[model samples]
Target: MSTAVTRLFIPRDTTALAMGADRLAREIAAEADKRGETVEIIRNGSRGMFWLEPLIEVETPAGRIAYGPVDSQAIDSLFDQGLLQGETSHPLCQGLTEAIPYLQKQQRLTFARAGITDPVSLDDYQQLDGFNGLKKALQMDGQAIVDEVKASGLRGRGGAAFPTGIKWQTVLDAVSPKQQKYIVCNADEGDSGTFADRMVMEADPYMLIEGMTIAGLAVGADQGYIYLRSEYPVAHQILNEAIDKAEAAGFLGDNILDSGKAFHLEVRLGAKAYICGEETSLLESLEGKRGMVRAKPPLPAIVGLFGQPTIVNNVLSLAAVPYILSKGGQAYADYGMGRSLGTLPFQLAGNIKRGGLIELAFGVTLRELLEEYGGGTFTGRPMRAVQVGGPLCAYLPESQWDTPMDYESFQAVGAALGHGGIVVFDDTVDMSAQARFSMEFCVAESCGKCTPCRIGSTRGVEVIDRIRNDEDREANMELLEDLCETMIYGSLCAMGGMTPFPVQSAVKHFPEDFNQPAQTNGAQS
Candidate 1:
């Protein structure tokens, strides 16, 4: 191995691509050639610190010095500044990539492979502890692997913090399937405040593939499918490439790792429907049907894609599998506090400075996350509420600042550490408008499979309007409360069910907005 090669790390994830990393990479390469530099640039998946996209790292005598959010215009300056030789004088430079507290503090397990190796090069992935878990899993009985996961306390990172071990155990105990058992990755990350899925897919594609392979081996699954959302076009492109590479390298094809496991994988995409983020809706889309959610009781594990025993796990949840398998479950599980286990990949977004992915053990308070890590509101305005979770998640006011970001603790305060996403809203934001938008968003995205979600969402908007219009604001508030109760009790999935949480929280937190007098021009004829 050429250990002395001048290594340059560039992000290739969707967010970085959206921020134009592709053009920047080409510029860096071209500039390197002009300067006669032997630059060995590696297009790795992002470190998930999205605020610093197009982040470039050049191996220096001191260490891997970093530069970020770089555009093509800065490439020439970067070359002139001796970036390949790592002088660290560029305008975009952020010295020592690893030293950034945001990236350093993260307990990166699922993200272990991310930003550490070439995303497409299976060899680089293998060099950095990739596929080792799958190999280790193949050595043991599948049941033993499942038991290890159960012990690790790794839960679903896609909103609901359900124990992964319990889900796997249930699937294992269900049957000794010699049939078409499937492993499905839910990559439909439509939630407004979350991009962890997109980052992982783009930054560490093979890690996800390897994680899926382990899940397949443990669950007797011979086929796997990833239901990627259509909005993540770049992620889809990268994942497709990774899958091909994995197959070529004998990691995802027939007799994968020569363990007699015939696991094959493919990708499916949803048509940008938010409801598709829900597992059932995702399965329906994966099965070549309309992305409508299926009623549960006959859960996806029992009757999943095309009527088979499927292991449907969120992208992060599945990605976290390798870590637990490589270093036993109890070892992974012993990280978090209370019922929450392991590290939470908290996605910080919206109206906040230092917005990016922050993965830490659960129990970090909202106040610390918002005021300290978030660096207050991006607008420099005082913050009013921190919407933890997704759009449906509750808008926790400043009063709830002390609430720790655990599932149960959040639930106690009419909130949730949903998918570990925290979207900050400044005081200037109109809560009534946000509440109305929540209802409107629900109406637009509802799968229409459930009555409350379909009709109640449309009605919720009008009810919110009634409160805003001062048509007996208190009475309208009561009506909206009734509507919330109906939606909470009646909706099929959490999409419609939890929409009320944010709406009501916003209204309760900012009551002045609901009672604001309608501004009318006197000259309106």
Candidate 2:
């Protein structure tokens, strides 16, 4: 008689890797061999709960049982506790992986398959309805696919909040001079406190591939490029592997699924420039030029890659297409409130007790995310400020915490939900210094394509330093505000344009912080 092989799942995500998942996996396998046990170890993607990372799961008759925040040293202890039999008595055991409240509450449309299957397994993906969207797309014409997307109420997830269907419609209507259109996935996610894009690429890469394929079919584009950030080496490697596997499995290449349509995809690494996160700068980088923003008149949809029409969409926006096509557009659109349809994968990071990814409908308040999911500050101190979007966004005070997390609500509050990254700060933080850092970040990251972004950021940093030092503080404060105004209206791109958001918000909300001298070392003056 044969015995069933004990199957264990370990995360191969970047966060899990940093938390020693690799070492723990090796230890578990060695311990199993020593005990004469037949164990099959499968490396899966993260569930996005970083607090319980290095999370290991044991496959059982009921379901997959989870244990987490595990270290290599726990391997012996885990085995002795009948981990293979899915024992729950162990201190580390976290019950059924699916039942965990953190995961159970999420409306995981784009990330549905994440952490549940082997990332590179084509067979596993197929069984989980992976290519169903692409299969459906093959049966529909380009107009029908675009119409479905239009009905979904999908907007750009890459900070801009632009209508995604409108952009696609323009590309579909455009007539490329060379008869060549391209689909470009702007994966250069450089915002602070943002890792959702990396999670998608590393955890469920085929979702992105399938999304891009559907986009190609929709826009009559044959070539696609993922302009990925150079910092994510793991994502880059995984994406390439997934692309290759997809081609071999008849999901991509000269003829997809024996259909007459064709789409070829590849990943090109950026030069570590923050500016390339903008669509035009990414196009320039992909064309082997220096990463710099191009002025708009001939939009990328009309004159794009190699002077041909193109469809440029963010990682999250494209990743949502598979779900939209599979379940129908209105089904995906039924989640969020108001015009902000569908769920957004909000990344909770910085000083917080339980920080991870929270995918919810758009109507949820920042207070709910910060308190319920984030569990307040990590230091257990009073939460002071929350910086949504990225470095270029406003540092929101507690009074504004109740604002809903959709595009219009945030905009109405003089803030923009750029990339859904929320960075929390404890009471010890200095808002004046934070305001200064915003200007400094702009000076360092601006591509120098325009004057206001280049020179204004440099002058703004100097003016902020003057105000912090109490050198003509009142005069410098007014001067700083005026300079911020110039940058806001004069800059060519959001890089220079939105630099004032943090600075202006800080001065407006925390006026007392600027009245005193800046903190020295770790002490406030």
Candidate 3:
């Protein structure tokens, strides 16, 4: 009986659960009972490949035979068709899951543990190479851990490419006799076209906990907080539960693993404000206040969160720490080219047909990801502009597709791989409309602290209208450019400053869209 136990993993993300994985689990168990197949099923998170929800795996002679978008009703037919041995008549039988080019091409470093193990199971996590980093860190001094991380060449994966090791060393060097040090994980990823953070949190909560635990040990931080956005209510619930489990098991809380290290962690919820994704705004939210961006110069590393020295990092930044510590920093550092080092968990989202998460090295090009990896736009129409990063990022044309995806590579070409989100749009999409939407999104989500962001965003929309209506189109275009310049150089934070990135990139890439514009039903022209 033990030898016959074939393990199968079922995606249990909220979307999958809603689509009926829970009932399907029961059905699989019952069907195995009638068929006399010794199969053990474990629930895991999506591969960020949402189109394949309720994804089911069957232990087979050839490997795991996957059938997706599956529900309870289909389980009987699956078992009857001998799917356990890889023979299936099910319509959803996507033969040979590993060979699916989209899933196969990804490097899957940070996501190596995802979609493969029970998310909350400590045993499963450890078996799949989880706590090797924390164990390694426990054997080293605080500064040593910081030094190792410094060599990894990992930067903030949230957007800004600040070095994680450098940030930790600052908190370590800070004078805090009467002061307390904090480890804050920025999980408030409000950036559209990005769900890499959310996927990590849900797929492997233990990885995040282990990552944060390592950060706390390195930075002399006893208390840690994960500032998760409220929009990700499902992820918030999953991580919070995992935190409780970890605390009970002595992996978290005081005297962790009897190492005499007093470390405790908590989860702080964000209230759907986009600004909270910023570290200062996140800190403000943690302090029971509105999410407003704070001034810099005295960076968060020096003075932050209840006036204490804080080591704040993005979700992916911390998640990558475990791998860096386990496999020497040089191993992780050697992956990328030039300034951008280590592997990146790139999210292929929006209009793309094969949209999902693709982890790869820094040197890959936009064209490879969009054409080869993405399988073109979802509409099967000619792919128009592709937006790398989130809404604040630029809408670039095919002319820039050959450009590499490294930090300086994208930036040199006037685009960014912000949060590693690649949103594609087909030929039908008008850059002018998307550019206008960028300003509109800013107007809706800005924290209203800075005058330019609070006011300029609304005006930017009006100016975009002047061009869209073709009312002195060329003049309006110049005025819009000037307004963008003001917002870029004048605004306090990225809310207003980066709004120009999408707008100007749109006009630069597709000037024909703004020239002699089309008339809507309500247009005065």
Candidate 4:
């Protein structure tokens, strides 16, 4: 490898970019030019440590030294402190990157290469065991590949914790001389507190590409589509560029490394409809139709995109494929507990200190995540409630903080580990208002295809208003509970079905918020 006179690592993730990483990058280059120094700048992804965005790293003989929350204004001072030489005396110096507690604590399986390499560089990706999984997969028959994933105990990282191997097997078995098969990667990551999908697409695009390629080989698919959200412009550009690189490098397209297997991939932008995050709705949107939820019985596995056999997976799920194929399924399964095997990229957001992505094995307690990784609330006040999963997940009170981050554990408490997102709320939050907001959110984002979610949510808002206004308080409360139950069992999809999770959870956990008579805005009951 050619030695650089000096090397700098700055993140281009949307979070970092929003924090002025782009401006800081330009300033660092200008400072180096003025000093007549040769510097190599590499734009890597964030290590999921959000509070320290615009995190700068300098490659040294000892290791990579880090500095964080840096802006253009700090470049001159950082350079003055001999940052290029790896000096740790600067105020912003964070010592070694890996040694950071937040990062060191994470069991980064899917995100192993994130924040560590040039995202689009094929050679850099290959040097880090990137394509080993694809290579191993190429040597195995389709049944062997499917069997390995089945043995891994890998469930969907997407909201539905369905068995991934079973989905692949159905697609594999559905294929015949006349049937076409496809693989779809759900990159429409709209869940609150979730950025794991966008991170993989932007930081290590090749990992996702390799994973999808393996899926193609396993299920007899020749075409794949990544349905990415339009909000992620940076990921869109990076993924498109990565797809081009992969196609040119023979990792994708008609022939795969001269193996005579065809796996062509493309990125399709979502219509910015939250409902499209659901698989059938996403398929409907992909076909140039209005985004609406579809009824089941003809599952997407058997009748998906263009009415063909398909495998629909989340970005995080597909990204894990490379590692599983490389090190064996059992090795990947060894990390977590119970049916929830393997690591999950759990995102910490909202009113939390040190909020970032924390990917760990299943079974970590919520208390540990909220206190240890989150460092409690950002405002330093006592935390009152936390919404695990996403906007529709149950609003867990502090009493339920001991719940483990596993499918069955969460299910036992009438909660879920949907998308592994944890959004915290401080004690000052009003659960009454929050309950109403859940209804409003569901009404706004609902696809109008289901009656329970569409009409029930509007009624839910009215019931909450009645309870807050003390209009037949006990009766309205009963009506509200009845409405939630109806939505949970009657809706066509989670949009209507799961909205009650947050509504009821708030009422169940913080009864005081709904028990009081009407009061002036912002007044404590």
Query: Which prediction has the highest lDDT against the true structure?
Result: 2
For every candidate in turn, the CA RMSD to the true structure comes to: 2.9, 1.4, 2.6, 1.7
| Candidate 3 lDDT tens digits, 1-525 | 244787777877766777787888888877888877788888877766666778887766677778887877777777767667677677888877777677887787899888777788788888999889999999899999999999999999989898888999999998776658999999988887888898899898888899999998988899999998888877887898899888998889888888999789999887778888878888888999988889896888888888789989999999999999999899999899997999998888888887778899899988998888888888898988888889898988989999998999888888888899988888877677888889999999898988778888898899888878777877878888888898899877888889899999998988877775645322122
- Report the C-alpha lDDT of model 4 over 1-525, residue by residue, as the tens digit: 555588899999999999999988988999999998899899988888998898999999889999988977788899899999999999999999999999998899898889999899898899999899999999999999998888888899888999999999998888544568889999999998888899999899999999999999999999999999899999999999999999999999898999988999999998678989999999998888988888886888888888888899999889989899999999999999988999998899999998989999999999999999999999998899899999889999878899889999999999998999999999888888889999998888899988999999999999999898889988888999999999999999989999999999998999988877546534345
- Scored by TM-score, the top model is 2
**Which regions in candidate 1 have their CA more than 4 angstroms from the true location?**
1-5, 176-178, 518-525
Looking at candidate 4, what is the lDDT of residue 260? Answer: 89
Cα lDDT for residue 97, candidate 2:
95
lDDT, candidate 1, 127-164, per-residue tens: 87777788889898878998998888888988887888
True-structure Cα RMSD, model 4: 1.7
All models: lDDT? 0.82, 0.92, 0.85, 0.90
Per-model TM-score on C-alpha atoms: 0.95, 0.98, 0.94, 0.97
Better of 2 and 4 by lDDT: 2
* TM match of model 3 to true structure: 0.94
Off by over 4 Å in 4: 1-4, 517-525
Any residue pairs clashing in model 4, and if so which? none
- Candidate 2 deviant stretches above 4 angstroms: 1-3, 520-525
Q: What is the TM-score of candidate 2?
A: 0.98
Would you give me the overall lDDT of model 1?
0.82
Rank by TM-score, highest first.
2, 4, 1, 3
